[model samples]
Target: MPAYEFPDRLNGNAVNAGDPQHRKNLADVLALLHVGGPQNRAELTRRSGLNRSTIARLVGEMVNLDLVRESEPRETGVVGRPSPVVQANDGIVAVCVNPDVDAIAIGLVGLGGKIISRVRHKTRRVPSVDKMISIVSKVVQSSLAKLDDECRIVAMGIAVPGIVRVDQGVVEFAPHLGWRDEPVAQLMEERLGYATFVANDANLGTIAERLYGTAAGKTDVIYLNGSRSGIGGGVIVNDRPLSGVHGFGAELGHTSVARAGLACYCGRRGCLETEVSLSRLLDIMGEASIDPDDLGPFVVASKDRRLRKEVDRQLDVLSVAISNFISIFNPEIVVLAGFLGELLEVNPERLLERVTSNSFHQLSADVELVRAGLRSQHLLIGAAELAFSPLLNDPISFAQLKA
Candidate 1:
């Protein structure tokens, strides 16, 4: 069995791990820091139920390993001496990638969800797998060269806009990108010399929301991400992401909303994506050539009657889909991300009113419909989280292996 297989037993109770007590302690400390964010030594001791002496020793060891840092002491307002704040070391960074049809976004994300640096590479045309790999590898090499020696690139994570077999790190299909059965993670690992994980873009977005955004501490959520080409979705149930049997379950955009609507690139008619995608909205408003980043301003400033009618039509369709999702998943939160977020920010009342009226009262009453909290960097942060998961879950074994 792998050393990382040990179950989490850190709930204010001591476990008899026999030979692995030290490892358990290390894992528990890291897990607490990751989940609870930065905390003082006293707070860590209280939350982990570990004795102060033990926490101090483990924290010191982690600090020595360049995994945790202690801030300058601050006075506690009482008669006691000041205590130092403890936080995860920012020097440990992960490479995060978000690949889209027009460009690829790459970031160096440090621990504690900090995006230290980022770069965007625009392509004149949709690049092939080999071409994308070459371009991204060069970008990654350049980024690495500019980083300080203390900033270690521990791992890499990629978010692709399509169905992915995450366990195998293979992109099963990305219709928009015309990619199929691509071993993205393996190829990236070979090129970058770091273990890589790949996941669907929307799924990563959902993880970001749950970890550090609007859906933090939420058990059930439905997330929708709108892009120029299409929309993507993810579902979280009981605090766990519901990636279907093949890790392609929450393709909510393809759900049929109209009986005989526009044709979709997925070879379906009336798919929700065809009706409500950003590209479709732009096309209807006669701005098909506008840059995607400028879409929010374009919509806000346009007085086109066609755009108004199209927005109204799509809002109704979106309401129907969201109402259906509410009935099906009974989620605690529904997050609209990307262009969908802009849509909500522009006219939240229209969508909210439609959804509330359409959905069952009892179900919709408790569901909070809101815009995405993470905004622009959610996907990048989500990828970093993927790379950080192994260490957060099994810090001791990971440390041992690395050493």
Candidate 2:
């Protein structure tokens, strides 16, 4: 409901701002405000293990850098004293782009995980790599032109539905979009002149959930979503994305679920995407696409025996994959999005039952299956996280604020 909330634990081993440690101190305080919502200096002092004087100085520096702002504390009946609250400045923005099979979504996201503005460009056909880039450029330029001079655009992040060499910002493969070894971020950075980053859409989704969605404050999480193109997902372990050494790991969509099912575009049989498809559900619904809000109601209100049976059947197959992930990852929560979310919405108990029975470690760990909290905006918000990474990691350098 809120744009962002407090994490279970603040990350970063930031000590007191002693000489070189000032950067870490600034990073730590900023991280608290950015990830854990607004808080007073007292709370920051407790969490960061910094003295009041150090925290006051750090917060003051960030305020000067325009990274955050302080507001008079709200009056609650039980409060002894209301200290000023430090919150991220929404004026600092990042350009987020996500190009899927049917549409290219561009959003301007501010600090504190706020979605300032969003627009989608629908396409009749799957646009090529070059075509998508062109569209993104147009949308970004037009959007930036409308912003006032105070609106600081620091970076741009693009989420691709493929294996990305995140360190290099190159897309190794995107079967849905028919791409390979595309230097998408580099091109955009050269054209737009802002720092750019590229990442796997599902990986971004996983991070977004941890940042502000259902998995917020969670350490280990599993996120899977079924869209028209296919299923894509990501995993989080110990609060870090399990992106593997090459950033090609955690390709959850292609995880083989069947010994021999339908062949997948990735040269595999019975891939999760091939087996559990959104198009199958949409075809049965007799619509090209269903509204995010209407999907559950339509499934619930409809008494069609065929639809009910199909939903159950897909759930049966999907449960096997979910259980497998639970056993392996031992995640606290498993997030299902898009059509898969519709499955959970229709019969949460039934799906949970199936997943529990199939999971090897079900008896050992309490795993909760939930829907994506950010819903349709998860991907865009996820892209925003990547764009915000640089600043979150090093507030001093990102803002060019020296000690």
Candidate 3:
């Protein structure tokens, strides 16, 4: 519930590429603060594996940078000292942008990993990337203006629904957005005047769950976003998303289930996206003479039945694909996020049953199929986390910031 409770430790303001000893001491202090919450000088020294003198010196610097703060004293019975607490500061704010189908969401996230402000702009009929970036920049600028200029706008994380070159800051392709080799980060930085990070929207969603949501601490996990555009996936191994050699690690939508099936945007036939995407599902229903999205107010208004059936079919296909993933990756958790995340909440047991039935017995035995705790905000939160994470490292400075 409190901020700074994400998967990995914070970066940028916490740890920098400084003297090894200084960084180690800072890391110790951070480890203590993260695990035990607020602690005084003496408590920090004891838990951080650092001496009292080292803690005193390091904490003084942190205080000056507004990265850490002192708290009131707490008394222990029969104790001669009432130790004052030193806590990690949660004032620093970062911006997160998620460019999705319906709209672009911008969120102001604090160092403690809590969202402080959020705004959404409709994509409208013409969802140009330029328009989306402009809107996002305005929202971020407005949010930052409210805080101190020294508020450490550490990083800006963006989630795009396309193939991204993480190190290159290039979007190789985005069929839905009609984008190719677009320098999204450069465009955003040009508009906002801060470093920007771009990642696959679905991958970011997976990171969102792995860092702050239900999949925390899991060694291997799969995050799936089953939306109308497509079903995207982000695969995590040892707490890191597998970006692959070319940054296209998990393209779940393009994976083919039926060898000779529906034509996909990728020039492939019978890809999973063609069958499981909401748009495709609607088409399927249309062919079946079942206007589930149109008829049945409960089916349309609530639309549980229609969605459930479609999700079931998708899950069946997912089961086969996931079964292969499990056999290969052997992940501990396979998280279903995105629009289907809401649906899973309504029929968890049923969905889990199908997934379990389709997965390998040995692999499915322990694998958990769960819905994401974070909803539409998953990608947004992931972006903030991506930027702020590097800042939270101890003895933090600009050098330790990631690209």
Candidate 4:
């Protein structure tokens, strides 16, 4: 027998194979119930472009697997026609982890998009590639052990903070992690037994929003996650993440907005990140004699008459960078994550207004700029979404492979 690994063990068989019509039919039904909420058989068939018989067969299989539930029948406008709504079952869970910035966060997520359990652990001082994976693996194992064995781990997602070539499972560059061209997914697969996926941290955040957060199904979305180093942007257009031919399409932080300004982590000067990122903003606040470590006190000071004036002055520079972004992407929504989102919560209308006033009138008119809903969990949840993505379109494939 092949060397077996605990927790990552697979049953060594191909995923389920049903008729193409059945697979497509089931996907449509799940998509409708997932995106549109519980719907009756007739509505599912109508929305999915499938025949009534196909819907019945797929729904029957789903009900047997406990992936969906049937609700009480309700009367429709058509006389004597009572249809029972089919609802998604939240028991099917996915495990996700974010390994970055010297910490790992693990979350158990359900199909209905709820986080069942979440925990965070420190990485101590070690920073090797193997050590990072081990940290995440341990956290996952511990979390899974807590759940009943019947609670199926449908998939796993990982969000790493650097350039991630998902197709290759190689993290090409992570200056912060001190890693270069590491096959993280393969390592995890060998170690854990379950399939895995890796993605750029910010890109995963975009998926989190598209999957369960506010940006669901929007054709055009630009997501920007902030940090002291810079802000990373994820672009989705026409229902796909726009990773360029080289899989690095949306590196917005490197875009030069000023010819003469602070140098960025990527060795560039006056990039938008140098001016608008949370770290840069904190640096500016420090110049005003505010203590960076005491962010709570500093925020309170910011609300004071004299302190708020200084903060607003600094925001003016960042607003210019956002305005430039508006002229280019013209996205329907731009989500701000990381520390910037917290700052925005403290001063919502101000940042919103600043971007609008600075951006082009026409572009700003249609664009809605907002902060991330996941907050500190953004990277962790994004990572989980990445790990689980490969299993989404093929439920039968997973069903065929027994544990």
lDDT of 2: 0.80
For all the candidates, what are their Cα RMSDs to the real structure?
4.5, 4.6, 5.6, 6.1
- Weakest 10 consecutive residues of candidate 4 by summed lDDT: 1-10
> Residue 223: error of model 1 in Å?
0.8
- Model 4 over residues 1-403: C-alpha lDDT tens digits? 0001112222233354758767656655765675466789998888778788878889998887667889888767787768788986756777777665545667887665567787766656535768866776777778777877657776677777789777767789877677789998788778877677677888878877776666765667888776533567888776677778787878877788778878766888987667665544455455422221244346656645544654564456556766777787777887777755555555767777888888889998878777777666667666654544443454566555532
> Can you rank all candidates by TM-score, best first?
1, 2, 4, 3
lDDT of 4: 0.67
What tens digits encode model 3's per-residue C-alpha lDDT throughout 288-313?
Answer: 22211222232335545666577667
lDDT of 1 by residue, 1-403 (tens): 0111212221112333345767767877876776567889999899888899999999998887778999987677877876789988878888998877777778889888888988777777776677778887898789888988888888888888898877778899988888999999888888778878888899888888887889887889999998754899989888777866655788999999998898887778998888887876766776534444456677788888788777778888999999999999999999988888878776789999999999999999979998889886888988887777777655655655566
* Off by more than 4 A, model 2: 1-18, 77-81, 145-149, 290-294, 301-304, 361-365, 401-403
Residue pairs with backbone atoms closer than 3 Å in model 1 (clashes): none
Winner on lDDT (1 vs 4): 1
Off by over 4 Å in 1: 1-24, 265-267, 284-294
Candidate 1 lDDT score relative to the true structure: 0.80
Which one wins on TM-score? 1
Error of 1 at 50 (Å): 2.9
lDDT of candidate 2 over 1-49, digit per residue (tens): 1222212111132333346678868877887787788888888999889
lDDT of 2 at 240: 73
Q: What's model 3's lDDT at 183?
A: 91
